[model samples]
Target: MPFEVREFPEFSWSFSRHKTLLTCARKYGYEYYASHNGWLYEADETAKHAYRLKKLTNVPLAFGQIVHELAEKAVRLFLKHGYVMTEAELIEEGRSMLNRAYLDSRDRKQLWMQKPARYKMLYDMYYKGELNRLEAEDYRGRLHVVFANLLNSRSFQDITTRPLSMQFQQAEEFRFMTVDGVKIFVVMDLLYRDLDAGKWVIVDWKTGKEAENDRSQLALYAYYIMQKYKARVEEIEIRNEYVLSGVNRTYQLMEEDIGLMLEKMKQSIHIMLRYQLDMISNEPVEMDEFPRTEYRQRCETCNHKEICLAQ
Candidate 1:
């Protein structure tokens, strides 16, 4: 296999930027530099909580990945067997696949995490001399077979046969090039294609429910696809599976919609960057505490609530 390396100058846009700017640009600016300056997560408890989640690549975000895997597998199985599965069956298979995948892929990603020593020490402790390299391979291969079997089961008909074909292609670091000379980094969830239409689409799988109007976060994905593939972004979908009624709703992307999002992201970067430059020129800066916001019903189950309430 061959891989190419590309570089985007020292800049990027993230969804957090869009939200932060919407809430408070001054806060965005101070936090951006404070974050990169290496003192933000350490001094601020909320920042620390956010940082930990972002760094969690193992089974942390596994639920959605597992769901997608099972759905896709079900589609394949349905294609082969001409059978459709209930949503409940698909969800159950998804959980099983997730556990298997976590155990199997743990070692492959062990080397790549920003923190390797953490897992390395854990692996060292768990390994037994009796099980050699061959045993490890057997363990991984068996799990892969199990996961594939679950994915190819019959219940995933709807998502599989749908006109939209999607795959998750992500890296801890994303290299982006823009007309403004902005190089961006992101952790992406899904990249989609309408094979029949030959158009590019981006989908982000959300475990929680979202409003139909809530699209600012996914707009960054549209921006990246437009720039990276040089193809007109036909649609941007945010699949929120964790809805109040447990239904998934998709929003279509219009040119104007993405344009506004980019404008906001750009403004956010500008605001944050300007403040960061000023702060660098100053003596020193301390990270701000996570500002308190109203706790919505949706936020009750959010992983960040503990830290939010603590603040």
Candidate 2:
């Protein structure tokens, strides 16, 4: 007798999910389908382990998350109170977050949800008495430098200077709608409506280098907003701010571009469906179904490399 495979749905498409599928289908299958069991502390041991592995984050991702969270909070505070932190204050806030998280993970080993990179910095700063240790974790203070760059960057400066009365928003704003049976979700880091220019600005902050995916993500945001607001593609402006490098790229969807991105979304949905059918209903999914990535270099940074074994 065999157990039943879970029924994979077509209606859930997130940028993160799309990214995984684009990166490596095998990894996508592992993350979304194989390792997607719900919390069942009383369930089988194997199930518990799978859930834990699904939730783990690596050092680089952890660092980015920290930066994003603190940045979001700091900006949220500023949007509400017109208060901005100085560089030294930002560094202190970052260190405090790192130190608290480090102590939490250190004391509770199994409950540790953070990566070792953060803990290493905190450990050196306190126990090892190394005052200059943030550099070691983020490599020459890259993390702090990037954070400062964001605080001082023109893009962010605009955010701070804007009056609280004008509608400035954060990622807590999201919209979901079904497009030909596929559910699409979009969240923006900051959204500001400029009545004077008659434009809707959708801003996304990036702590990493520019990539084609970044552009694709902006396209998706534009498409979704066009659908949600029934606004002209020309009225929607998408801004991608790479804070680390102080580079800002803005994109707007033309009428033709909207059609193209929608088609792209449909194509991605079908690709995911093709992989889903192979993985869920069948055992020993054919290698060709969720084909390993041709670019082996990407495997080095992938979290599911061990499971994928993609050369």
Top model by TM-score, which number? Answer: 2
Q: What is the C-alpha lDDT of each candidate?
A: 0.45, 0.65
Tens digits of per-residue lDDT for model 2, 1-311: 69443433233788888888888876676667555443443545434443444554544554566677777877888877878877777767766766555555446444432332223323222233343344436632666787778887655777776654355644555577788866788877777776666778887888888887687777778777777778787888888878778887887667777677788888888776675434434333443466777888987655555445633
For model 1, how does the per-residue alpha-carbon lDDT over 1-311 read when each residue is reduced to its tens digit? Answer: 59422221124556555565455443443334333322232345444334333333323234444555554555455555757666556545655654454444445443323332233211221222122345334433333333343334221222366624534243333555453655555445445555554545444444434555346666666667777767665644443333113344455677898788777767766754553323324322233433333435633433333334454
Model 2, position 55, has a per-residue lDDT of 57
Off by over 4 Å in 2: 1-11, 99-107, 113-136, 170-174, 277-289, 294-301, 305-311
What is the total number of backbone clashes in candidate 1? 4
Lowest summed lDDT across 10 adjacent residues in model 2 is found at 117-126
